[model samples]
Target: MSKVLYIKANIKKEGESRTFKVADSFIEEYKKNNPEDEIVVLDLYKENIDFLRPEDLGGIFGPKDETSKHHPILKYAYQFADADKYIIAAPMWNLSIPAILKAYIDYISVTGITFKYTEKGPVGLLKNKKAVHIVSRGGEYNNTPYEMGDRYLRTILGFFGIQEVETIAIENVDVMGVDLEEKMEDGIKRAQLIAQKF
Candidate 1:
């Protein structure tokens, strides 16, 4: 069975977060469609995900000794690399993903684990993996320059050799006069459709 990694990067719970609402629908559909698949959930808010420190940098750049091999950060990278599929749920904060999510990305972006540098350039190691981003925005940002969250995710995931990436956005959430329920319903429908094939 394929392994699916579900990364939850929001402080708000599923009942209160618009992003989680749509992501929940997608995950539910995905589970129904692929009951044999394994799902691993990582809640950033509940986890002790911290920013990179001096020791972390040393461990990453230093020699591959026993301490480095057993470093706590490497577990995140190993788990990320082992997954066949990824689902990231977050809200747009200042036109980008949450800082904690970025920190998690930092943990997983390990050299020789996710990517490797060659004579030509840095090449991703994990190939044939798929990913999807479920994001909620206060305003419309898709297809616009202001949209950086999904764009950043697509770029970074591509860096890790995951080329097949899709995004389901719940937009205009805070816009005045917008039908929030309708937008949510539309996002749910799209999410469910993607989940069927994801």
Candidate 2:
């Protein structure tokens, strides 16, 4: 049974966050598909970590010992580095992810732990892991540069040696004349398919 880390980055309630609901649908199907797998959920809103604070340096310097580590940088980094798979669910705010989600990323992107620089260049430590991003966007920007959330997540995960990354995007959700329910259903349906194959 593999360990799957589910990161919920939205502040909205369970049913209010489109991305969260889609991810939950995906997890529901994932659990059905892989009954033995372990799923861990980390809600960013309730998680208090000063990710933007410059004084917190455990992530960059790497934890010296678990006994001495008192901050969330090592805690979040270890959780991420130890996971076999990841599920990041969030919505695009101002053409990017919410600040809390970005902060969570900062907490997890630990140097010499998640990734390291060698003579050849930076190398990802956990090459065997996989990741999936379930995001909801108000506008359509799937293949465009405006999709900063997807692009940044892909890049950072790739930097950590997770080469297998998938995205389930619910685009044109608000601005376009598309029905929210229909778009959400389609996203959930797609998530089910990915869950089976993942």
Candidate 3:
């Protein structure tokens, strides 16, 4: 079965989050279509994601080090390395991903595990994995400089060897004078379509 890692960053709208509804619909359809696929949902709000401290960095790179002392971070890296696919659902916060999501990225970006430095450049170790990102934005900023969340994810994940990335966005959800429900419904429909092929 394909191991799918789903990372959830937010569920509430007030917190610059309006993507959960669409993400939930996508996940439901994905489960229905790919029932055998394993979906591991890591909700940042409900879980304690490890922070990449100096000591944790040492544990990852140091030879003959006590890896058990850094079990949490090591586990996170292994989980990331084992995944065949990934789904990240997060709302745009100030033109960037949520802080919790970024923290999770740090925890998983381990040297010699996710990626390794080479003579020419850094090479990603988690080969052949694909990722889909679901993002929500408050205003109309599609294809603009303000759109950084999607690009950042693609860059970082690509650096770790997952170059095949797809982004599904629910934009303009919080724009003033917009029909919130209708916009959301449209986003949900789009997400559902994406799920069918996901």
* C-alpha TM-score for every candidate: 0.95, 0.93, 0.90
Q: What is the Cα root-mean-square deviation between model 3 and the actual structure?
A: 2.6
Alpha-carbon runs more than 4 Å astray in model 1 = 63-70
Q: List the residue pairs that clash in candidate 1.
A: none
lDDT of 3 by residue, 1-198 (tens): 899999898746433456877788889999999999999988877777756778777666665244633476677777888889998998899999988889888877777778998998899997888988998888887899988888999999999999889888887887789898888898888888888887
Off by over 4 Å in 2: 68-70
Q: Which pairs clash in the backbone of model 3?
A: none
- Give every collision pair in model 2: none
lDDT of 1 by residue, 1-198 (tens): 899999999988569999999999999999999999999999988888999988788767655544554678877887898899999998999999999999999999888889989999999999999999999999989899999989999999999999999999888999999999999999999999999999
lDDT of 2 at 46: 82
Model 1 backbone overlap count: 0
Question: Candidate 2 or 3, higher TM-score?
Answer: 2
Which candidate do you rate higher for lDDT, 1 or 3? 1
Q: What is the alpha-carbon lDDT of model 1 when measured against the actual structure?
A: 0.92
lDDT of 2: 0.86
Candidate 3, which segments miss by more than 4 Å at Cα?
11-17, 64-70
Candidate 2, run of 10 with poorest lDDT: 62-71
Largest lDDT belongs to which candidate? 1
